[model samples]
Target: MDKTFTYQELQKYNGKDGNPAYVSYKGTVYDVTESDLWKNGRHQNLHDAGDDMSLLIDQAPHGVEVFERELVKEVGKLV
Candidate 1:
C-alpha cells in the first residue's frame, strides 16, 4: 500500500541516526536517508529532510535531474 504522511509526521524521520530521512518534492515523499549527500538528514548543509522542497528546487544549482541522478526513491506522498 502507498504510504501517506502529514507534514508533522514526516518531520520525525529527519535523517538522524536510526531515523529514516524523508523529504517531499512536488507532493511526493522520497527516502533520502541512504544518500551520502543527505547524511545526517542534511542536503549540502542547506536543506534538511521532513519538509517540502518544491520551492527550494529553484535555488538549487541543479534541477530535478538531481533526483534522477541521485537514485532517490519515492516512499510515500505528503498529505
Candidate 2:
C-alpha cells in the first residue's frame, strides 16, 4: 500500500541539508533527489521541493509526462 503524507509531513523531505527531495503533483509525491535538475531541492531555480506542483506544472512547457519519462520514483500521495 502506498504511504500517505500530509503537506506538513512532506516538508521534511525538502532535499536540504542532506534531506531527500520530494515534490507533489496531482496528489502524488515523487522523489526527485536523484535528478540533477532538482539539486539542492530547487528546479531550474523556478520551483522548490516540498511543494504541490499541480498548478505550476500546468504552466510548464512540458506536461506531466515528464515525470514518467524521467522515471521519477513515486514516493507516496498527498493528503
lDDT of each: 0.85, 0.89
Number of the top candidate by lDDT? 2
Instruction: Write down the lDDT that model 1 would get.
Output: 0.85
RMSD of each: 1.4, 1.2
Give the CA lDDT, 0 to 100, for residue 37 in model 1: 85
User: Model 2, range 1-79, lDDT digits (tens) per residue?
Assistant: 2799999988888989999999988889999999898999999899999888999998988899868746479989999
Clashing pairs in 2: none
lDDT value for model 2: 0.89
Those runs of model 2 whose alpha carbons end farther than 4 Å from true positions after fitting are none
TM-score for each candidate, following the candidate numbering:
0.90, 0.92
What local lDDT does model 1 show for residue 57? Answer: 97
Q: What does candidate 1 score on TM?
A: 0.90
